[model samples]
Target: MQTVCRDAPGCPEPGPGYPDLGAVPLVALNVSVRRRLGLYLNPRAAVAADWAALAEALGYEYLEIRALEAQPDPSARLLDDWQGRGGATVGRLLELLRDLGRHDILAELRGRIEEDCKKYLQRQEQPVQVPAVDSSVVRTLEMSGITTRDDPYGNVPELFDAFICYCQKDLHFVQDMIKELEQTTFKLKLCVFDRDVLPGSCVWSITSELIERRCRKMVVVISDDYLQSNECDFQTKFALSLSPGARQKRLIPVKCKAMKNEFPSILRFITICDYTNPCTQKWFWIRLAKALLVP
Candidate 1:
């Protein structure tokens, strides 16, 4: 239910004095945030004095430790200190990273962090419906280490960036596609049949999983040869079925070669990449990469 307000035709107040209602906050450190940030900062370290300065300001006596084994990451130690400092938030850390000129790592992290924050705020605005449960059941669930914080899809991680759908005749193009998309700086993980599929696995079962769950997008290589192959036909249709009306834009059609047969009627609405174009070759990979990146 939505309550339209006088602020705008379709707008409404989120709550009383909405913007200041803590709907969006500069998130403080938690175990998950620490673990994520630790990974990003692990490979990039500030000077010892810089870290020491930040630590000292945050009430830590020293950033050093005496140990027989390799020390815990300085980044992790800093995050722990930040947590203990009573809500030293991510915004403060971003300012430090920016000042240190770690822009190489800062660009992606800052973009993703901002996006995640926006999502968090949006989620906070939505009404939550908590079902009634017995106190004993709630305790049992807690004892079993289950909570509302658990990710629904955490167990089933998508292993491939995109699934390459092509016929054997188009394998050479797929090889080239891999060279351009995966081998270069893009470093995309593509699920190609010959390269990624297990030798003894059930083909139909595995292919279904790859299309439906494992991969984020399905790159369909279209050509006269590709149209002739039954497997390519099946895979294309299956991918389309999963995202009817192309709602997710998960099915990406690439015209690797001139096609004598008509384009699939089902995919007519989709804007495809035409490799046949000589002028747009330079921008093709970048455009495709951007498409794959869109969440």
Candidate 2:
């Protein structure tokens, strides 16, 4: 039986002259066919160099070499040199790539990319064993591989440039808000406790840093319990520690629970944002976003 195939634009088709006994199954040939996938190098020369060992380790096979550089021949020679070196360097490079690849994508995209990378690696005859990953490794990989210049979230800047200062009592609430905010294109680098505190940092230092410099805005989750806690007091006080010349107002008092009296002395200057009213909460995020000046 003769099989008709879709030919490329302006490309001639193999006709009756083409030798085909039709004895072989088409699926068998298609099964081993390599896929054209994207592999980006930080310096870009990695592809042109045909660093197969490096490519193999990174689970890449072919490089769609770019035309910007004039000496493609020399680049090929470099790849030949690297390949013949027994690929110790390539192995190391692959290890680094595997460790670093996890962090470059958003939550949704990360898993798919990882699976694809593994499959590609397997096809290249250098199947990489999965390694146990920790948050630090993930963070390192993410920061290293991210293609965007400085912005962590690609084109979308965070919704709140300011730091979010809230008590542990409202962790769930803050987390929920963060989840909701992420669903939108409006991003916020909201600093909640537990999540933002670097593992090695001293507790008080982390507190001080988040309040003092890291955050562009301060959001105090107000409730009687939060006001009573020493930890909360220190955090709030540090947030209020900003000098007069700071670009945005230092405090945004979010009334998480209704109170008969006003907020404490330090928070009294800023207008209260009541979370009770949906409109107020919406307005609070809007104003907080505005204060952040996120583009």
Structural similarity to truth (TM-score) of each candidate: 0.47, 0.41
- The collision pairs in model 2 are 103-142, 158-187, 159-187, 159-188, 162-216, 162-217, 163-215, 163-216, 163-217
- The list of candidate 2 runs beyond 4 A from truth reads 1-160, 244-247, 260-262, 278-282
Q: Model 1 scores what on Cα lDDT?
A: 0.59
- Model 2 TM: 0.41
The candidate that achieves the highest TM-score relative to the unseen native structure: 1
Per-residue C-alpha lDDT of model 2 across residues 113-200, encoded as one tens digit per residue: 3333333233223213346745445443333222222244323322235556667777776776677554556666666566544354
Report the C-alpha lDDT of model 1 over 1-295, residue by residue, as the tens digit. Answer: 2221213223234555333212223332223344565566555345422444445455554324222013355555555434434445555565455554445445545445545545444423422335674454443332221212222334424367899999898899999989988999989988888876645444555576668767899999888887567577657756765675578989999989887766654355689998889999888889988888777
Indicate the worst ten consecutive residues by lDDT in candidate 1: 142-151
Reference-based lDDT, each prediction: 0.59, 0.44
